[model samples]
Target: MITMVRNVSRWFKVNRFMGKCTVIGVLLAFVAVACLGQLASVQLLNGKSTAQAATASRTKTVTISAKRGKILDTNGAVLAQSVERYNVVADPELAQTFVPTDCKEKTAGNCQQIDGQPVGTTGAAAVARLLAPILGMDAKELGALLSGTGQYVVLKKEVTPEVMRSIDDLGLNGCVYGELSSERLYSNGTLMGALLGGVNDEGAGVAGIEQMQNAVLTGTDGYKKYERGGEGVEIPGTVTESKDAVDGSDVELTIDANVDWYVKKVLSDAKEQYKADWAIAVVQDVQNGQILALEDTDQYEAGSDDAKLNTSRAVSQTFEPGSIGKVFSMAGMLQSGAHQLTDQFTVPGTITKNGQTFKDATQHGDEHWTLAGILEQSSNVGMVMAGENFSNEQRYEFLSKFGIGQDGLGLPGESDGVLTSAASWDGRTQNTVLFGQGYATNALQVTNAIATIANKGVKQQQSIIKSVTDANGHTEDAKTGEPTRVIDEQVASQMMNAMESSAEHYSKFAGVDGYRVAAKSGTAEVAGSDGRLTSIISDWSGIIPADNPRFVVTVVMKDPQGSYGGLTSGPVFKQISEFLMQKYEVPASTPRTDAIAVTW
Candidate 1:
């Protein structure tokens, strides 16, 4: 019985131990399965989101500024350009953590030490102390900027590359950096100042050509996305995305800088000598209608506030063209077969027609003059008689064809001038229109009108921009419309012959040596600042080497000391024509053999 009882006790003890082992194994299996499930969830289901959160903490995006294009003259001279600059930027939050290291050995760049001792300051104060001298700022002011809690702050803007390099040499451990930027620089101070225009603080064009071609001059900005370390340092091989900026296209103008400078100087001198309110001048290539030089007296320094505010007077101001209108009317007469240049007329000093009395500049007895002679003498009565057969519609039609009161150059703030319908003309205005009093036009219109006669009756589109070269170096010439024939070629020749005779009348005052000029002068009464019809506008337009025209020059002055256009503006014409001839090496004029008789 004792052996049986001992065996039962041993068996029961063995079973209980096995049962405990089994329970422990089952618990261990359950714990292992829970750990595997947790590991899968972390590695597969939520891994991407967790990794994205980590990247968001360290990644940063920065702007890469596009370089603005340059404005160049036809001769490849730089008129306006962008100079490389930088904006000194700082991370105020990071700057506040800046700490200088103590110098143990006297080695350069080994430690942040001032005068062979440790920098005795910490955080933003230490940064400010090192940066203030280089930046030319007060240490206290810089410290305040750096003590802010913002991540980004502009320390100084438009710093030169030299200054930026010096700042970089300090090695501020990523607390400060330079953002690439540029400054628009006009190399020639006040040359074409108001016309070239200026940029705003944000580098956008606000006036003149800068505003007109803003799209061509502006570029697309790019960006860079990368990871940075805790110290604001970009991590190696962590740049995830980046795109390079596209620089703006370079614009080349049709103007010659040297000629423009000379024209401006001449206009300025004339404005002072004549004691006039203002003066304007324009020169154009007759063959292609490309404007060579356009200038006015109200010049301002480029990049100045005045440059931003003022419009170009050459294309903006309007006035009666005075007797310069004779060329258009005479062209009309010859074109419509109303009269021939050789036709005879006995013109008195004054005459009345259609209840309107007209007079010449000077009183004279009855003179036997041909149509050509009538024009040479610039007789208002002669034009009235010549236009006896010229219907009002014919008058308006000819003026329209000649581009009077028309849009010119399409420049900013350009005026199209005023030309009322023929139906609006009164009896006095109808006769006055025949002599250039009833309509108003700008200087450019007058210039191109005469240019049409010089171009053998063909009118070419005027162009200021010569070409555009894009960032990829692809070049394209400025687009323009096709030339139009304004009149028969024979009629243009007759007008040119008549104009040559008129030019001789002003030869003493406006003649260019060795060049035959086809010229006309005009003096008109315009409204002054007080809106009184007392102001005098004296103007002269001429084509040099008339037989083979190359350049057409025009000069206009307001309220000049000398009232007559031929007397006041004539000499200016001579000076500019002389320069054009000498500079271009133009051949001297051939003797006139086909000259028509002015007296019948």
Candidate 2:
């Protein structure tokens, strides 16, 4: 019984050990299966992440530049425009190993021979020989560039479409590339050059209206997002996103191209005739305040390096206005009820006031003169004596009212001109101010200031831009400011009478055949460093068909060789006026009148 019991105990111990082993084996199998599941999950997640990364790497985004706007004149002629240009690029390595596939009857043997490498020099020479004449380049120079080690090199820039087409017909097979580009072209070279401004290679406006209205002239750039292939090439039918570019708006100016051409021609002739350092001209519609022409001799090409330095002198430069400014002083005195057009005063060759001496343009004896005669004589003493009736405050008020030192006309570099405040005036300055001295003004300011008289003392704001047209063909007209009454109609009419008489003094140059004309001529001395007269600013301002006064024309010349305003600028003003009258077909307002009295 004990043996049997021991055997049972041993058997029971063996069975329990086997049971434990079986449980441990099952646990081990479970752990292995859990570990394998976790590993499989990690590998699956990693595989998905890697695939996503690979897909992301194949995507590319391209930005497309918007088409720049056009700059058009009032007559819808293109003054400045963005034109399609190209850059010729060569894959030197590809060119070195090129094989011309276009085997025409005339080039088959040469093409086939180019495919062979008998000479140590690569096939670049063969390619250059075929491309040289069409590209306007020498074969040797082209061969050297094509034989270089670089993968890509620029062969030519700003090539014409015809040249590009010729290059394309050669079938160079990845050896040559024509990259698209643009250039700013001025249709009328050097006409309105400074006002039209310039653009860079990327078609960004850098100066003038182009710079001032760049945002309006430059459109929104678009973008394209596409998937690329493994070789970094665009994949077929894989564009993820695309947005078309919006072209810029077109800017139409108030300047008439035909008138501008004529004015420039007249000024050029005057500039040459007078042997002057600078010449400027401007024409305006006195009734509407529209500037018909603004020109200066200092002009430059659109794409030239000198463009940055060259600016419109009429807009930016200022000089002593000289006798041209007297029109305003006379208007002030008349409006102040201090003088009448027929009022008589004894005028002398010179007058001294507050230790400052004023004189007539030339030596003359004392004589009785009417207001009209005083102006016709352009007497500094007469102007000072007439202005003495009004206070300094009255003179400054008139100057400001006449548009002196007013806000800029919205040009890029417009000047407001100089007008001394009453508080800054000394005895000399106060007296000199009466005769249009001790202050300075630009051509535009002087032209507009005198225009107040021509417009019957209605000051109209000047403008350059006429309208803006968007890509969708919607045009928005540019607003010109309202006209303000600066003087009474009666006062203006009386001033006009005096101006007509004054203009008659220059009748030799200003008188138009069968037409009544009103004008004023001035010669202001340019002060030297020692406060003495060194140079002269000669100018003429006038109205055409003086009886009705449709247009106001002004001509200014600086430092002319031995000439005054009537001699240098008067002829230019007359020619411009005649051309304008004929061009606009303005009929005669009244019969021609005799010369008014200069001395009484």
Candidate 3:
């Protein structure tokens, strides 16, 4: 009985201890609930909990590409443009099991044979058979692609919209689809090709103005984000974000299409007649520096393998300018008051300095020549005699002022033709440079130098781009720099008069029937395959309507078989000058004259 009582007492004590622990546990549970409630309140005040935010909404975003800009001539003629194209893509795994809508009605084992294909064929075979004719693809080749396990595959690219429309009519969405894209199209084929440049497969500009101004021509692409439904369709009115694509701007070039086309024709003719390796030409407005025409025989067709070749020979190719460079030295001499148009010198047939003898292209006996006569006769000996009047430093300054050894008129790949400073000039180098040798210059630089004379000693920055029109229809004019006076107006006039004498007395081929022309012709020796000076670069540059000074045209033909600039490039300049006069309806300012004397 005592043992039973002690057991009951211990059991009571155990029960009491258990009750106290249970109460303590309830208090701890209450504290945890209160803490959790406070945390929940804080989170609710901030907006959303991390887990709830993650599961709150789902969105799918899609990118829309902006339309690439158009490259247009000053006349609004499209030079380079983006054309709408499509890419044929497929989900190969899905396409392998996809059934055409037309075949759906023939579920009784004949669906694979709907297109007269083999029976019991794979879904890919059926799809390929139906699409081959419309897509202009080989059925067997296409079937191999469709039967692949890849989820994404590009079947074809750059298909026309009409073909894409026809494919859409087939209702093969689950198997094949068309993605909208763009490809550049050149309307003129190879005309102004190098200047306009070409685009790559990614629809980005790769060369010429297309590359230089890509950022301005390439617009911003936008996107739209919206919630998707269970079936993968966008839920109605559940768009989370949206933005419109900005189309690329329109690049209006300074090139006049009509004049440029004519110049190209002339260049082509010169290339054919001269049988030369290459030809280049440039026409600039003296007052404004607008490049009316820039052409080359090495032009390439856009998007063609030929495009990989260098095409803008006018800006890219440099050569020893030969006699044409003499004009700048003459201008500099006159501007510096070192010489006058009336200064006379008895020029020997040849002059020697530093173990080098300088002679005119054509040998002649000693003759007396006035300043004008020196230029009219294109006497290298006379040029050398006058070159001694200026120090080496002064001569170098003159060349620099004439735009030699300067970065070209803002063109890609334009060479800053080689020019050794006066500090490095030797006796032979000095005399050679006096008549345009020992240094290199591109066709445009030569043209710019002559244009400076035509502009009455002012140098205007040359420009090929006229304006840029943005997507919003806003047009920005080209920032052609202001004209900087480089010489006295009187000196420029005297130089022009002497050039007129040259055209009338020596370069008769450069003169127009009714228009006064001031011009110079040059022939420089180019090494041939035999390592001898058997090749020549024929070149001519001039200003028309000498009294009024309207246009400056320069032409170059390299390695012509048997001709000089007066024979090959002169006619080209004349034809183009006549066209420019007629196109602009320019009136004859001064009657053509032939009274300029080459000798006393």
All candidates' lDDT scores?
A: 0.90, 0.79, 0.81
Q: Clashing residue pairs, candidate 3? A: none
Q: Provide TM-scores for the models.
A: 0.90, 0.82, 0.85
lDDT of 3 at 95: 71
Q: Which stretches of candidate 1 lie over 4 Å from their true place?
A: 1-47, 102-107, 110-119
Residue 390 alpha-carbon offset, candidate 1, angstroms = 0.7
TM-score of 2: 0.82
Best by lDDT: 1
Over 91-180, each residue of candidate 2 has an lDDT whose tens digit, in order, gives 787787775444467765444323343332347987787778788899899999998897668898888888898787666665786766
The worst-scoring run of ten residues by lDDT in candidate 3 lies at: 109-118
lDDT-based ranking, best first?
1, 3, 2
Q: Which candidate is the best by TM-score?
A: 1
Better candidate number, 2 or 3, judged by lDDT: 3
